[model samples]
Target: MRRLRIIGIGAGNPDHLTLQAVAALNTLDVVFLPDKGSEKGALRALREEICRRHVTRPDIRMVPLAVPKRAEAGNDYRGAVDDWHAALAEAYERLFRDHLAEGETGGLLVWGDPALYDSTLRIVEAVCARGLALDYDVIPGISSVQALAASHRLVLNGIGESVLVTTGRRLAQEGFPQNAGSVVAMLDGEQAFAAIDPAGLEIWWGAYLGAETEILASGPLAEVSEEIRRRRAEARAAHGWIMDTYLLRRSR
Candidate 1:
Protein backbone atom coordinates (compact mmCIF):
# COMPACT_ATOMS: atom_id res chain seq x y z
CA MET A 1 0.00 0.00 0.00
CA ARG A 2 1.88 3.00 -1.31
CA ARG A 3 0.93 6.16 -3.14
CA LEU A 4 2.76 7.04 -6.40
CA ARG A 5 2.70 10.57 -7.72
CA ILE A 6 3.93 10.82 -11.32
CA ILE A 7 4.62 14.47 -12.13
CA GLY A 8 5.41 15.81 -15.56
CA ILE A 9 8.54 18.03 -15.62
CA GLY A 10 7.96 19.61 -18.99
CA ALA A 11 10.48 19.37 -21.86
CA GLY A 12 13.83 20.92 -20.93
CA ASN A 13 13.04 24.21 -19.23
CA PRO A 14 13.01 24.75 -15.51
CA ASP A 15 10.13 27.17 -16.01
CA HIS A 16 8.14 24.29 -17.46
CA LEU A 17 7.81 22.83 -13.95
CA THR A 18 4.32 23.60 -12.77
CA LEU A 19 3.46 24.91 -9.29
CA GLN A 20 1.69 21.63 -8.60
CA ALA A 21 4.79 19.70 -9.66
CA VAL A 22 6.89 21.74 -7.27
CA ALA A 23 4.45 21.08 -4.44
CA ALA A 24 4.49 17.35 -5.16
CA LEU A 25 8.28 17.31 -5.20
CA ASN A 26 8.34 19.06 -1.85
CA THR A 27 6.26 16.41 -0.12
CA LEU A 28 7.35 13.11 -1.63
CA ASP A 29 9.04 10.47 0.51
CA VAL A 30 11.10 9.39 -2.53
CA VAL A 31 11.51 10.40 -6.18
CA PHE A 32 12.63 7.91 -8.82
CA LEU A 33 14.65 9.14 -11.81
CA PRO A 34 15.66 7.01 -14.79
CA ASP A 35 19.23 7.35 -16.01
CA LYS A 36 19.87 6.80 -19.70
CA GLY A 37 23.52 5.76 -19.22
CA SER A 38 24.81 8.49 -21.48
CA GLU A 39 26.44 11.87 -21.02
CA LYS A 40 23.30 13.43 -22.42
CA GLY A 41 21.79 13.63 -18.95
CA ALA A 42 19.90 16.80 -19.69
CA LEU A 43 16.64 15.19 -18.62
CA ARG A 44 18.07 13.68 -15.48
CA ALA A 45 19.91 16.87 -14.60
CA LEU A 46 16.73 18.85 -15.07
CA ARG A 47 14.90 16.55 -12.69
CA GLU A 48 17.69 16.94 -10.16
CA GLU A 49 17.56 20.69 -10.52
CA ILE A 50 13.83 20.72 -9.81
CA CYS A 51 14.42 18.81 -6.60
CA ARG A 52 17.28 21.03 -5.65
CA ARG A 53 15.23 24.16 -6.17
CA HIS A 54 11.85 23.20 -4.75
CA VAL A 55 12.78 20.87 -1.93
CA THR A 56 15.35 21.97 0.63
CA ARG A 57 16.24 18.58 2.08
CA PRO A 58 12.52 17.94 1.69
CA ASP A 59 12.85 14.47 3.34
CA ILE A 60 12.59 13.12 -0.19
CA ARG A 61 14.77 10.27 -1.34
CA MET A 62 16.17 10.60 -4.86
CA VAL A 63 16.55 7.30 -6.65
CA PRO A 64 18.61 7.35 -9.83
CA LEU A 65 17.71 4.13 -11.56
CA ALA A 66 19.45 2.89 -14.70
CA VAL A 67 17.13 2.14 -17.58
CA PRO A 68 17.69 -1.01 -19.58
CA LYS A 69 18.38 -0.60 -23.26
CA ARG A 70 15.64 -1.59 -25.68
CA ALA A 71 15.96 -5.07 -27.11
CA GLU A 72 16.89 -5.66 -30.74
CA ALA A 73 16.38 -9.36 -30.29
CA GLY A 74 14.08 -10.09 -33.18
CA ASN A 75 11.82 -8.68 -35.86
CA ASP A 76 8.95 -8.50 -33.37
CA TYR A 77 8.84 -4.80 -32.53
CA ARG A 78 5.86 -4.92 -30.17
CA GLY A 79 7.27 -7.89 -28.29
CA ALA A 80 10.57 -6.12 -27.69
CA VAL A 81 8.83 -3.14 -26.14
CA ASP A 82 6.59 -5.36 -24.07
CA ASP A 83 9.56 -7.22 -22.67
CA TRP A 84 11.34 -3.95 -21.95
CA HIS A 85 8.36 -2.54 -20.07
CA ALA A 86 8.20 -5.66 -17.96
CA ALA A 87 11.86 -5.30 -17.06
CA LEU A 88 11.43 -1.63 -16.24
CA ALA A 89 8.52 -2.44 -13.97
CA GLU A 90 10.60 -4.95 -12.10
CA ALA A 91 13.27 -2.30 -11.59
CA TYR A 92 10.74 0.17 -10.19
CA GLU A 93 9.27 -2.38 -7.81
CA ARG A 94 12.72 -3.15 -6.48
CA LEU A 95 13.42 0.54 -5.93
CA PHE A 96 10.05 1.09 -4.30
CA ARG A 97 10.54 -1.74 -1.86
CA ASP A 98 14.11 -0.80 -1.07
CA HIS A 99 13.74 2.96 -0.61
CA LEU A 100 10.07 3.80 -0.25
CA ALA A 101 7.97 3.39 2.84
CA GLU A 102 4.89 1.21 2.80
CA GLY A 103 1.80 3.38 2.15
CA GLU A 104 4.05 6.41 1.94
CA THR A 105 4.19 8.93 -0.84
CA GLY A 106 6.63 8.58 -3.78
CA GLY A 107 7.03 10.55 -6.97
CA LEU A 108 8.32 10.00 -10.50
CA LEU A 109 9.27 12.99 -12.63
CA VAL A 110 8.30 12.31 -16.23
CA TRP A 111 9.37 14.33 -19.26
CA GLY A 112 6.49 16.17 -20.83
CA ASP A 113 3.06 14.84 -19.84
CA PRO A 114 2.69 11.19 -18.98
CA ALA A 115 -0.29 10.97 -21.32
CA LEU A 116 1.83 11.90 -24.31
CA TYR A 117 4.42 9.63 -25.94
CA ASP A 118 5.98 9.04 -22.53
CA SER A 119 6.30 5.53 -21.08
CA THR A 120 6.41 6.29 -17.36
CA LEU A 121 2.73 5.56 -17.03
CA ARG A 122 3.20 2.24 -18.80
CA ILE A 123 6.06 1.37 -16.47
CA VAL A 124 3.89 2.27 -13.49
CA GLU A 125 1.05 0.17 -14.84
CA ALA A 126 3.43 -2.73 -15.17
CA VAL A 127 4.14 -2.45 -11.46
CA CYS A 128 0.44 -2.45 -10.70
CA ALA A 129 -0.09 -5.57 -12.81
CA ARG A 130 2.11 -7.45 -10.36
CA GLY A 131 -0.64 -6.97 -7.71
CA LEU A 132 1.28 -4.25 -5.95
CA ALA A 133 -1.50 -2.08 -4.62
CA LEU A 134 -1.00 1.65 -5.10
CA ASP A 135 -2.90 4.73 -6.13
CA TYR A 136 -1.33 7.05 -8.71
CA ASP A 137 -1.87 10.78 -9.20
CA VAL A 138 -0.74 12.36 -12.50
CA ILE A 139 -0.04 16.07 -12.91
CA PRO A 140 -0.22 17.25 -16.48
CA GLY A 141 2.58 19.43 -17.81
CA ILE A 142 3.05 21.26 -21.10
CA SER A 143 3.83 18.89 -23.98
CA SER A 144 6.63 19.47 -26.49
CA VAL A 145 3.97 19.39 -29.20
CA GLN A 146 2.43 22.39 -27.51
CA ALA A 147 5.84 23.98 -27.16
CA LEU A 148 6.59 23.33 -30.82
CA ALA A 149 3.34 24.95 -31.85
CA ALA A 150 3.96 27.83 -29.50
CA SER A 151 7.49 28.31 -30.78
CA HIS A 152 6.24 28.60 -34.35
CA ARG A 153 3.31 30.82 -33.28
CA LEU A 154 1.06 28.50 -35.23
CA VAL A 155 -2.08 26.87 -33.92
CA LEU A 156 -1.93 23.09 -33.75
CA ASN A 157 -5.34 22.74 -35.37
CA GLY A 158 -7.17 25.14 -37.62
CA ILE A 159 -10.73 26.38 -37.04
CA GLY A 160 -12.39 23.15 -38.22
CA GLU A 161 -9.65 20.83 -39.39
CA SER A 162 -8.09 18.07 -37.27
CA VAL A 163 -4.51 17.41 -36.19
CA LEU A 164 -2.74 14.07 -36.20
CA VAL A 165 0.01 13.48 -33.62
CA THR A 166 2.31 10.69 -34.73
CA THR A 167 5.85 9.33 -34.37
CA GLY A 168 8.73 9.32 -36.85
CA ARG A 169 8.41 5.61 -37.47
CA ARG A 170 4.76 5.82 -38.51
CA LEU A 171 5.39 8.95 -40.49
CA ALA A 172 8.09 7.09 -42.40
CA GLN A 173 6.44 3.72 -42.97
CA GLU A 174 2.80 4.67 -43.40
CA GLY A 175 3.43 7.87 -45.35
CA PHE A 176 1.05 10.78 -44.85
CA PRO A 177 -2.50 9.82 -44.03
CA GLN A 178 -4.88 10.34 -46.91
CA ASN A 179 -6.19 13.92 -46.74
CA ALA A 180 -4.84 14.49 -43.23
CA GLY A 181 -3.18 17.77 -42.38
CA SER A 182 -1.16 19.19 -39.51
CA VAL A 183 0.91 16.22 -38.40
CA VAL A 184 3.26 16.43 -35.42
CA ALA A 185 6.14 13.95 -35.57
CA MET A 186 8.07 13.04 -32.43
CA LEU A 187 10.65 10.54 -31.24
CA ASP A 188 11.86 10.48 -34.80
CA GLY A 189 15.43 9.27 -34.69
CA GLU A 190 15.46 8.32 -38.34
CA GLN A 191 14.24 11.56 -39.90
CA ALA A 192 11.06 9.83 -40.99
CA PHE A 193 9.64 12.78 -42.82
CA ALA A 194 12.11 12.10 -45.62
CA ALA A 195 9.77 9.29 -46.61
CA ILE A 196 6.94 11.66 -47.45
CA ASP A 197 6.75 13.77 -50.54
CA PRO A 198 8.03 17.14 -49.35
CA ALA A 199 5.94 18.96 -51.95
CA GLY A 200 3.13 21.07 -50.48
CA LEU A 201 4.38 20.22 -47.00
CA GLU A 202 5.70 22.76 -44.52
CA ILE A 203 7.85 21.88 -41.56
CA TRP A 204 8.55 23.47 -38.17
CA TRP A 205 11.44 21.69 -36.48
CA GLY A 206 13.04 22.32 -33.12
CA ALA A 207 15.68 20.47 -31.16
CA TYR A 208 15.90 20.57 -27.33
CA LEU A 209 12.66 22.54 -27.53
CA GLY A 210 13.14 24.96 -24.63
CA ALA A 211 16.77 24.52 -23.80
CA GLU A 212 19.48 27.07 -24.49
CA THR A 213 20.93 24.93 -27.23
CA GLU A 214 17.59 24.85 -29.02
CA ILE A 215 17.59 25.03 -32.82
CA LEU A 216 14.49 26.05 -34.74
CA ALA A 217 13.91 25.70 -38.46
CA SER A 218 10.81 26.23 -40.55
CA GLY A 219 9.96 26.69 -44.21
CA PRO A 220 8.77 24.80 -47.23
CA LEU A 221 9.84 21.21 -46.70
CA ALA A 222 11.12 21.00 -50.23
CA GLU A 223 13.39 23.98 -49.69
CA VAL A 224 14.50 23.25 -46.13
CA SER A 225 14.41 19.46 -46.10
CA GLU A 226 18.13 19.09 -46.63
CA GLU A 227 18.81 22.07 -44.38
CA ILE A 228 16.94 20.41 -41.53
CA ARG A 229 18.88 17.22 -42.00
CA ARG A 230 22.17 19.08 -41.94
CA ARG A 231 21.14 21.17 -38.95
CA ARG A 232 19.94 18.12 -37.06
CA ALA A 233 23.25 16.42 -37.65
CA GLU A 234 25.24 19.47 -36.60
CA ALA A 235 23.21 19.94 -33.45
CA ARG A 236 23.55 16.30 -32.50
CA ALA A 237 27.26 16.34 -33.15
CA ALA A 238 27.75 19.58 -31.23
CA HIS A 239 25.85 18.42 -28.19
CA GLY A 240 26.62 14.71 -28.42
CA TRP A 241 22.87 14.20 -28.34
CA ILE A 242 19.60 15.87 -29.22
CA MET A 243 15.86 15.68 -28.64
CA ASP A 244 13.86 17.10 -31.52
CA THR A 245 10.19 17.44 -32.52
CA TYR A 246 8.65 18.82 -35.67
CA LEU A 247 5.25 19.68 -37.11
CA LEU A 248 4.32 19.19 -40.75
CA ARG A 249 1.31 20.78 -42.37
CA ARG A 250 -0.40 19.93 -45.63
CA SER A 251 -1.18 23.54 -46.38
CA ARG A 252 -4.02 25.67 -45.06
Candidate 2:
Protein backbone atom coordinates (compact mmCIF):
# COMPACT_ATOMS: atom_id res chain seq x y z
CA MET A 1 0.00 0.00 0.00
CA ARG A 2 1.12 3.55 -0.73
CA ARG A 3 1.05 6.35 1.89
CA LEU A 4 0.23 9.96 1.19
CA ARG A 5 0.78 12.88 3.56
CA ILE A 6 -1.05 16.15 3.06
CA ILE A 7 1.11 18.66 4.89
CA GLY A 8 0.03 22.23 5.51
CA ILE A 9 2.86 24.69 4.80
CA GLY A 10 1.08 27.71 6.28
CA ALA A 11 0.35 31.04 4.57
CA GLY A 12 3.20 32.03 2.28
CA ASN A 13 5.82 31.79 5.03
CA PRO A 14 8.57 29.21 5.26
CA ASP A 15 8.69 29.74 9.02
CA HIS A 16 5.06 28.69 9.21
CA LEU A 17 6.19 25.14 8.46
CA THR A 18 5.73 23.18 11.65
CA LEU A 19 8.32 20.72 13.03
CA GLN A 20 5.93 17.88 12.18
CA ALA A 21 5.50 19.18 8.64
CA VAL A 22 9.28 19.35 8.30
CA ALA A 23 9.62 15.77 9.49
CA ALA A 24 6.98 14.66 7.03
CA LEU A 25 8.79 16.47 4.25
CA ASN A 26 12.02 14.72 5.06
CA THR A 27 10.33 11.32 4.97
CA LEU A 28 8.69 11.74 1.61
CA ASP A 29 10.08 10.09 -1.48
CA VAL A 30 8.41 12.69 -3.69
CA VAL A 31 6.75 16.04 -3.05
CA PHE A 32 3.95 16.94 -5.41
CA LEU A 33 3.83 20.65 -6.22
CA PRO A 34 0.78 21.89 -8.08
CA ASP A 35 1.39 24.54 -10.73
CA LYS A 36 -1.68 26.77 -10.88
CA GLY A 37 -0.64 28.45 -14.12
CA SER A 38 1.84 31.26 -14.63
CA GLU A 39 -0.24 33.82 -12.77
CA LYS A 40 0.32 31.93 -9.52
CA GLY A 41 3.99 31.24 -10.06
CA ALA A 42 4.79 32.98 -6.80
CA LEU A 43 2.70 30.45 -4.92
CA ARG A 44 4.62 27.56 -6.47
CA ALA A 45 7.87 29.33 -5.64
CA LEU A 46 6.81 29.61 -2.01
CA ARG A 47 6.30 25.84 -1.78
CA GLU A 48 9.68 25.26 -3.40
CA GLU A 49 11.21 27.65 -0.88
CA ILE A 50 9.65 25.69 1.98
CA CYS A 51 11.21 22.49 0.70
CA ARG A 52 14.52 24.20 0.14
CA ARG A 53 14.60 25.60 3.68
CA HIS A 54 13.10 22.69 5.58
CA VAL A 55 13.70 19.41 3.82
CA THR A 56 17.26 18.54 4.80
CA ARG A 57 17.38 15.43 2.62
CA PRO A 58 19.23 16.32 -0.56
CA ASP A 59 17.98 13.42 -2.67
CA ILE A 60 14.23 13.98 -2.26
CA ARG A 61 12.51 14.62 -5.57
CA MET A 62 10.07 17.46 -6.18
CA VAL A 63 7.46 16.82 -8.87
CA PRO A 64 5.53 19.64 -10.52
CA LEU A 65 1.96 18.73 -11.38
CA ALA A 66 0.06 20.93 -13.79
CA VAL A 67 -3.32 21.77 -12.29
CA PRO A 68 -6.35 21.84 -14.56
CA LYS A 69 -8.21 25.12 -14.69
CA ARG A 70 -11.74 25.19 -13.38
CA ALA A 71 -14.64 26.09 -15.62
CA GLU A 72 -15.73 29.70 -15.88
CA ALA A 73 -18.45 30.74 -13.41
CA GLY A 74 -21.98 30.10 -14.64
CA ASN A 75 -25.37 29.16 -13.20
CA ASP A 76 -24.18 25.67 -12.19
CA TYR A 77 -21.20 26.60 -10.04
CA ARG A 78 -21.32 23.31 -8.14
CA GLY A 79 -21.35 21.32 -11.37
CA ALA A 80 -18.37 23.25 -12.65
CA VAL A 81 -16.47 22.52 -9.43
CA ASP A 82 -17.42 18.86 -9.59
CA ASP A 83 -16.07 18.58 -13.12
CA TRP A 84 -12.88 20.35 -12.09
CA HIS A 85 -12.31 18.03 -9.13
CA ALA A 86 -12.90 15.03 -11.29
CA ALA A 87 -10.24 16.16 -13.73
CA LEU A 88 -7.84 16.77 -10.83
CA ALA A 89 -8.51 13.29 -9.48
CA GLU A 90 -7.54 11.79 -12.85
CA ALA A 91 -4.35 13.81 -12.92
CA TYR A 92 -3.51 12.85 -9.34
CA GLU A 93 -4.18 9.19 -10.03
CA ARG A 94 -1.80 9.27 -12.96
CA LEU A 95 0.87 11.10 -10.96
CA PHE A 96 0.78 8.57 -8.14
CA ARG A 97 0.77 5.57 -10.39
CA ASP A 98 3.59 6.79 -12.61
CA HIS A 99 5.83 8.60 -10.14
CA LEU A 100 5.17 7.12 -6.71
CA ALA A 101 6.14 3.52 -6.06
CA GLU A 102 3.99 1.26 -3.94
CA GLY A 103 4.81 1.32 -0.19
CA GLU A 104 6.61 4.62 -0.60
CA THR A 105 5.59 7.85 1.10
CA GLY A 106 4.56 10.79 -1.08
CA GLY A 107 3.56 14.26 0.06
CA LEU A 108 1.52 17.25 -1.08
CA LEU A 109 2.33 20.62 0.52
CA VAL A 110 -0.87 22.59 0.81
CA TRP A 111 -0.97 26.31 1.56
CA GLY A 112 -2.48 27.09 4.91
CA ASP A 113 -4.33 24.44 6.88
CA PRO A 114 -5.74 21.73 4.62
CA ALA A 115 -9.04 21.73 6.52
CA LEU A 116 -9.98 25.32 5.68
CA TYR A 117 -11.05 26.60 2.27
CA ASP A 118 -8.83 23.95 0.69
CA SER A 119 -9.92 21.12 -1.57
CA THR A 120 -6.86 18.86 -1.37
CA LEU A 121 -8.56 16.55 1.10
CA ARG A 122 -11.67 16.35 -1.02
CA ILE A 123 -9.57 15.66 -4.08
CA VAL A 124 -7.75 12.95 -2.19
CA GLU A 125 -11.10 11.42 -1.28
CA ALA A 126 -12.09 11.56 -4.92
CA VAL A 127 -8.85 9.83 -5.90
CA CYS A 128 -9.55 7.04 -3.43
CA ALA A 129 -13.10 6.70 -4.64
CA ARG A 130 -11.62 6.06 -8.07
CA GLY A 131 -10.05 2.88 -6.52
CA LEU A 132 -6.60 4.14 -5.62
CA ALA A 133 -5.47 2.09 -2.64
CA LEU A 134 -3.71 4.57 -0.41
CA ASP A 135 -3.40 5.54 3.24
CA TYR A 136 -3.21 9.22 4.08
CA ASP A 137 -2.68 11.62 7.00
CA VAL A 138 -3.26 15.34 7.40
CA ILE A 139 -0.72 17.59 9.17
CA PRO A 140 -2.20 20.92 10.16
CA GLY A 141 -0.48 24.29 9.88
CA ILE A 142 -1.33 27.98 10.48
CA SER A 143 -4.33 29.01 8.39
CA SER A 144 -4.82 32.33 6.56
CA VAL A 145 -7.53 33.26 9.07
CA GLN A 146 -4.99 33.00 11.87
CA ALA A 147 -2.42 34.87 9.80
CA LEU A 148 -4.95 37.66 9.10
CA ALA A 149 -5.86 38.01 12.77
CA ALA A 150 -2.22 37.92 13.82
CA SER A 151 -1.28 40.55 11.25
CA HIS A 152 -4.10 42.78 12.53
CA ARG A 153 -3.28 41.97 16.19
CA LEU A 154 -6.87 41.00 17.03
CA VAL A 155 -8.85 37.95 18.09
CA LEU A 156 -11.24 36.32 15.68
CA ASN A 157 -14.14 36.51 18.11
CA GLY A 158 -15.23 38.82 20.90
CA ILE A 159 -15.92 37.64 24.44
CA GLY A 160 -18.19 34.56 24.33
CA GLU A 161 -19.16 35.18 20.74
CA SER A 162 -19.15 32.99 17.64
CA VAL A 163 -17.35 33.47 14.36
CA LEU A 164 -18.44 32.28 10.92
CA VAL A 165 -15.93 31.31 8.27
CA THR A 166 -17.55 31.86 4.88
CA THR A 167 -16.94 32.62 1.20
CA GLY A 168 -17.35 35.88 -0.73
CA ARG A 169 -20.30 34.58 -2.74
CA ARG A 170 -22.14 33.65 0.45
CA LEU A 171 -21.35 37.02 1.98
CA ALA A 172 -22.84 38.74 -1.04
CA GLN A 173 -25.93 36.55 -1.31
CA GLU A 174 -26.73 36.09 2.40
CA GLY A 175 -25.87 39.65 3.49
CA PHE A 176 -24.33 38.60 6.83
CA PRO A 177 -24.62 35.81 9.32
CA GLN A 178 -27.04 37.24 11.86
CA ASN A 179 -25.80 35.03 14.73
CA ALA A 180 -22.11 35.41 14.00
CA GLY A 181 -20.25 38.04 15.97
CA SER A 182 -17.45 37.93 13.44
CA VAL A 183 -17.24 36.76 9.85
CA VAL A 184 -14.01 35.73 8.19
CA ALA A 185 -14.23 35.65 4.39
CA MET A 186 -11.88 33.68 2.16
CA LEU A 187 -11.67 32.93 -1.58
CA ASP A 188 -13.39 36.25 -2.20
CA GLY A 189 -12.22 37.43 -5.61
CA GLU A 190 -15.35 39.55 -5.96
CA GLN A 191 -14.43 42.14 -3.29
CA ALA A 192 -17.78 41.44 -1.69
CA PHE A 193 -17.03 43.89 1.08
CA ALA A 194 -17.99 46.66 -1.31
CA ALA A 195 -21.58 45.39 -1.35
CA ILE A 196 -22.19 45.53 2.37
CA ASP A 197 -23.17 48.50 4.53
CA PRO A 198 -19.94 49.52 6.19
CA ALA A 199 -21.54 51.37 9.11
CA GLY A 200 -20.84 49.95 12.59
CA LEU A 201 -18.55 47.29 11.19
CA GLU A 202 -14.79 47.00 11.55
CA ILE A 203 -12.72 45.05 9.04
CA TRP A 204 -9.22 43.56 9.17
CA TRP A 205 -7.87 42.55 5.78
CA GLY A 206 -4.54 41.30 4.53
CA ALA A 207 -3.06 40.17 1.19
CA TYR A 208 -0.04 37.96 0.45
CA LEU A 209 0.12 37.46 4.19
CA GLY A 210 3.37 36.29 5.82
CA ALA A 211 5.22 37.05 2.60
CA GLU A 212 7.51 40.01 2.03
CA THR A 213 4.98 41.50 -0.41
CA GLU A 214 2.30 41.43 2.26
CA ILE A 215 -0.34 44.16 2.52
CA LEU A 216 -2.53 44.99 5.51
CA ALA A 217 -5.54 47.31 5.95
CA SER A 218 -8.08 47.83 8.67
CA GLY A 219 -10.38 50.31 10.51
CA PRO A 220 -14.04 51.21 9.96
CA LEU A 221 -15.29 49.52 6.80
CA ALA A 222 -16.58 52.79 5.36
CA GLU A 223 -13.28 54.49 5.99
CA VAL A 224 -11.03 51.74 4.57
CA SER A 225 -13.14 49.81 2.07
CA GLU A 226 -12.17 51.81 -1.00
CA GLU A 227 -8.56 52.00 0.11
CA ILE A 228 -8.42 48.24 0.49
CA ARG A 229 -10.02 47.76 -2.89
CA ARG A 230 -7.54 50.14 -4.48
CA ARG A 231 -4.60 48.49 -2.78
CA ARG A 232 -5.91 45.04 -3.72
CA ALA A 233 -6.21 46.01 -7.35
CA GLU A 234 -2.76 47.59 -7.34
CA ALA A 235 -1.23 44.51 -5.73
CA ARG A 236 -2.94 42.16 -8.16
CA ALA A 237 -1.86 44.24 -11.11
CA ALA A 238 1.68 44.26 -9.80
CA HIS A 239 1.91 40.56 -8.93
CA GLY A 240 -0.45 38.94 -11.47
CA TRP A 241 -2.16 37.04 -8.63
CA ILE A 242 -3.14 37.57 -5.00
CA MET A 243 -4.46 35.54 -2.07
CA ASP A 244 -6.26 37.56 0.56
CA THR A 245 -8.53 37.09 3.56
CA TYR A 246 -10.54 39.41 5.80
CA LEU A 247 -12.50 39.46 9.03
CA LEU A 248 -15.64 41.57 9.46
CA ARG A 249 -16.80 42.37 12.97
CA ARG A 250 -20.10 43.89 13.98
CA SER A 251 -20.54 46.30 16.91
CA ARG A 252 -22.07 44.55 19.86
For residues 112-181, what per-residue lDDT tens digits would candidate 2 score against the true structure? 9999988899999999999999999999999999999888999898999999999999998887677899
Best by lDDT: 2
Error of 1 at 217 (Å): 0.7
Q: Which residue segments of model 2 deviate by more than 4 Å?
A: 37-39
Instruction: Give per-model CA RMSD.
Output: 1.4, 1.2
TM-score of candidate 2 against the unseen true structure: 0.97
Write model 1 residue lDDT over 82-107, tens digit each, in one string: 99889999988888878877878888
Q: How far out, in Å, is residue 14 in model 2?
A: 0.8
- What's the alpha carbon RMSD for model 1? 1.4
Rate residue 157 of model 1 by lDDT: 77
TM-scores of the models, in the order given: 0.96, 0.97
